[model samples]
Target: MSVPISRLHVSHDAPLLRHVSEHASRTDWCYMHADVASAYHPCFSERLLQQMLQTQERIRRNLAADPDPKAGIHHLVLASDSDVFNLGGDLQLFSRLIRGGQRGRLLEYAQLCVEVAFNLHQLYDDRVHSIAVVEGDALGGGFEAALCCHTIIAEEGAGMGFPEVLFDLFPGMGAYTFLTRRVAPVVAERMMLDARVYPVEELLRMGVVDMVVPRGEGRQAARELIRRNQRIGNALRAMNTVRQACNPVTLDELLKVTNEWVDAAMRLNDRGLKTMERLVRAQQRRAQAAAPALTLV
Candidate 1:
């Protein structure tokens, strides 16, 4: 069940927090939050992906039917939980799938991830701009998910990285695809392979972060950015279109790399699996601790 902004309501099974903020008759912002405290910890679960896809389609249709070029689903901001933005793919799910030799299930999960990321990346073309307001941690696929947005507005002191290399696997999602867009290929390599969480400032300097606001101001910063964009929305949208056209990262490209991720995950030996298992426990613990502050409603 998807929420209709014109007639707003949250589905009983919707994984994320959905809220619509009215700015004016001209613009409406739909904020879909990452609101999960399970092992997924807002990981790209199948449920979350399906709900988000349905929401996106609904917003697109609403906007398309409007007469104003900038009318309908003008902006999409990916908000986060009170703390961590996301910890990455569901490590526990991966462990189970790999241990059970369910390679197909694992690949299907990766495909779902790709579909969400690729769809968000494609939204810039529809006059629907995507921004990720990262307030806390965004690691591995978490970082990749942020990169999918047209703009990433992060809070100062927030951490972001790809720690897949720690377990002998690589972040095969859109990490490289998106990172290289703002920085050099070599620099992108360092961030992924180092597996060390980098400070927001470092990423800002490296050009990965479009804007870094003071801590606790991520959502406000995102809104300010949106307001500024709305002033010259047409120009911004056109430039975004040109930028995307010049260096397009297609769904095919992401799918190819994600499949490679599946292969690497499948080949993980005992030591690597142990490392992954450790992360799974850590993620669950983190989620449990953050539970009091979380609510899907």
Candidate 2:
């Protein structure tokens, strides 16, 4: 059964989440739309993560094998529900991983998500337009995922931010690099460091989101953008030319920066882990206490 966005989890089975395992494997321009019906519950299930890794590997192989690369996919649009895009990783599971001394596994999980983010970025770099239709809250890894896309389209009521600092942690995914690329460094810094939540208008002002559509028309607006881009054949190739002409930092270098942050997160075991544990516990208590009042409807 499809769980409510507030109740969904990686551990909880939903056909859509299970379907993500097979999404990246399909070649020939995947016009993907992510409508995470249940937003707050982001489990990062073992099965789904494993499948995502496999699918990514398949994409890499396909990209490498293509003798003549061409622009594919009209565009990939990730759609969200009425209130939020994604609430991010399931903190309960994360706390379990941390408490169990499964740092290696946790890092591996984070790295897989990192790889996915980079792959998405490369797809955009190659001229395949990827759009994020954010209708609700997009926090932590969810925000990182949205940043990986080429364009972000949100509705008027949307909220986007990174609030992981409260848990004594940071977004181990590609939030740092992606945010810096999409918006000004100062704005990204404010978001990450201050854990500030930006409203739709504010995000638009900063140029983080390309367009703000009507409340329920985010998906339609995104597809329109994709269709417009599709009219230009070899879109990705043209974008690559511009990138080369501008002499921007290479993808390999960006990956290096992302990995350095991962390494730092991995090193947070001795004192850092203990500190994080306390912080997370306090947060969990507050969330648990407030759960009944935090209604989605």
Candidate 3:
């Protein structure tokens, strides 16, 4: 028997939830909500990432148990809070890791991120559609995470970009791989090295964003897109499969870049880490300011 999704507990502390509705359809949208005022942003903690991984595993198992394919989740949507999608990596963690010379731990984090990027990019077996809903700023690793999805549905005022260059490091998890797949390598390189935050509209124009909707409409747009595509779902999946076969995003490449990232991280001087620390403080401030009406969905 299929279990009720609400009762399906992947992790008690996962800071995410599942709901069922017509618009939700065969879609599993997990919205992350947590206090940014905490030293660690909800999205970038080791504990949170582990919970998320467990949740995905559980979801996959549940889907496999379900006999009806259409009744199962056809799409997975990642939603975030209203003000900031994510501030990227936990700067505090990075600062400590870099200073303490915790190379292995840093690599582990990178590997975790790669696993996340690859699994989402593959759409959990290519049978499930994947969409990223960006309602606000998605920076650095956060932007890379969004790009890993098959489609990025962002609000009109949402923003995304790589600010990693400013900190003397690159977004080595999946930015280069995903962005290059979507655009030219030169274009990807320029975008990353420039360190500018691009608006959702500009990204939509550049073909980076699949859809841009009004504020508070990202979830609606994602559901609507899935519904519209359902008519030709078979064809859509077939085309994506063919594309993957032709030019696959390989794990080897992800690991290679991640290793390079760790090495570069070891070379960061005080100046770079200071910049990262400042960013961390900025996140804390944002969390404090938005605490009253802050929400994730």
TM-score of each: 0.88, 0.71, 0.88
Considering summed lDDT, which 10 consecutive residues are worst modelled in model 1?
A: 1-10
Per TM-score, the best of the predicted structures is: 3
Off by more than 4 A, model 1: 1-14, 21-40, 70-73, 124-126, 293-297
What is the C-alpha lDDT profile of model 2 across 1-297, one tens digit per residue?
011111112343443232222233222232211223332233344444444444444555555565555535434455542245666665555667766767665655665566656665554345345567787777777788788777888888878887777655667577767787777778677788677778878888888778988888886786566556666647555775575467453445445655665566555555666655665565456445544444433
Alpha-carbon shift of residue 291 in model 1 (angstroms): 2.1
Quantify all predictions' global Cα lDDT against the true fold.
0.75, 0.58, 0.75
- lDDT per residue for candidate 3 within 226-265, as digits (tens), equals 8887777777677667868888887778889999999999
Which regions of candidate 3 deviate over 4 angstroms?
Answer: 1-24, 34-43, 68-73, 295-297
Model 3 residue 212 CA deviation (Å) reads 0.9
How far residue 196's Cα lies from its native spot in candidate 3, in Å, is: 0.2
